[model samples]
Target: MAGCFDVMQHNASFDWDTRRNTYSAIFAGFLFFFAWWLVIDTAVVFTPTGDWNNWYFALAVSCSLSMFMVNSVSNRALEGLYSEEGVLGVKGTRIWLMFGFIGSFACIIAGIWIMFGDYVLQKNDNPKWPGVAIFLHTLLTFIASLTYKFGRSEELWD
Candidate 1:
């Protein structure tokens, strides 16, 4: 009950670190959950013949991989605070981060391709929900990863 009032207040401010972190985490979690829910529900509810293949899950899978690549290194490490001790140096972190961004963008491009090449351009009796779900999965997961990675202030934590 007390927690409900705390979350219900519209006058919340980022000045409160715990509040900011809580809100960001909640928002990111909601987006991720909703995205997966939509994709899975669409896949199950609108299963067409021979068209609903494994390729539809590529977007979500790639997004998860990208998130791992991007966030596996801590912000302190990226900032060169622990350059000498880690197996992956600052340069390696940068390289991984770069590839993560690349993979993230690639998945989005693939989503677009699935939406157009598979569903839009294909002249079949298949439902278009798969394509749309794939695209939304990529987009929402990317956004959620960004939110979880950047929205919190880890600099304050030890």
Candidate 2:
């Protein structure tokens, strides 16, 4: 039953710092902010070439929604199957979180595809930074999300 919940438990012997939770949260927050910063820079540095250009900014929106999906579930929801607290049972919660992870990963892959296919592969005068920036945004967000989810001290909150 522990499966995914294994990391939720505290391990004092492996701890590098007494403030592990605080540090993990700070790192996660920085990553999240940096992710948005990169995407916003993409939005600012590049003007819309046309309605099609709007897809660049749309990636940010999609990443944000997917981030919400990943972070929306509580750790406890997955820890207890028989508990009456969550409306969604353990299986449902697991599925919801799974979809979230999938969405986030998909966003990053799409960003990579756009970077190479649209900018790198093409011989247009357009700079490659925009594509790279978008990819960074999605990748950073995905890393930040997983870090926030798994890096925190679950027992501290309990």
Candidate 3:
């Protein structure tokens, strides 16, 4: 909310510019959508199930909706860092990141456990094709976003 930031800034006696404020909100919206594109949309490729498990797509759509919520909360937070107002904090944004981080990890862990499961079941002759490698690769893309910035913001200068 603008008031939240306004209250904080006013209490600190810092002058906030309306132009910068406008830009920050706009930038937050941009990053929220971009992050969805990079992370959630990528996840969708893995879920082609015809049923409701189409959640990967739902997640992507929800991430887009949250863009507005994130802007309403205040935009600057989403522009640069991973703090509260950041794109990462928006409900959908946070969910997608979690899905990518935890969901991907769960898939990887399951794949590994399956390998052991197969071994114990005396199916050792079976190839180690649990699909773990693919899951890991997807998760790594998310991690890569941390080191590599991929969105544009008015605050960012070349």
Please name the candidate that would achieve the greatest TM-score relative to the true structure.
Answer: 1
Q: Which ten residues in a row have the lowest lDDT in candidate 2?
A: 45-54
Each candidate structure's TM-score, on Cα atoms with residue i matched to residue i, is: 0.82, 0.80, 0.29
**Distance from true position, residue 90, model 3, in Å?**
3.4
Q: Which digits, one per residue and each the tens of the lDDT, describe model 1 over residues 1-158?
A: 66777666485446656666777778889998988897888777766555567657767877878977876767887888873758878888888899998998998898888888888777867778778888888899889889878887775676
Model 3 clash pairs are: 1-73, 77-85, 77-86
Q: Write the per-residue lDDT of candidate 3 for residues 13-117, one digit (tens) a residue.
A: 433343444444455445444554554443454345321133333433433333333223322433335445544466655455445445434544543454355
Global lDDT of model 2: 0.79
Better of 2 and 3 by TM-score: 2
Instruction: Rank the candidate models, highest lDDT first.
Output: 1, 2, 3
Candidate 3 runs further than 4 Å off: 1-92, 119-124, 129-158
**What tens digits encode model 2's per-residue C-alpha lDDT throughout 63-90?**
7778889888878787773448567788
Worst 10 contiguous positions by lDDT, candidate 3: 144-153
The per-candidate count of clashes, in order, stands at 0, 0, 3
Q: What is the lDDT of residue 9 in candidate 3?
A: 39
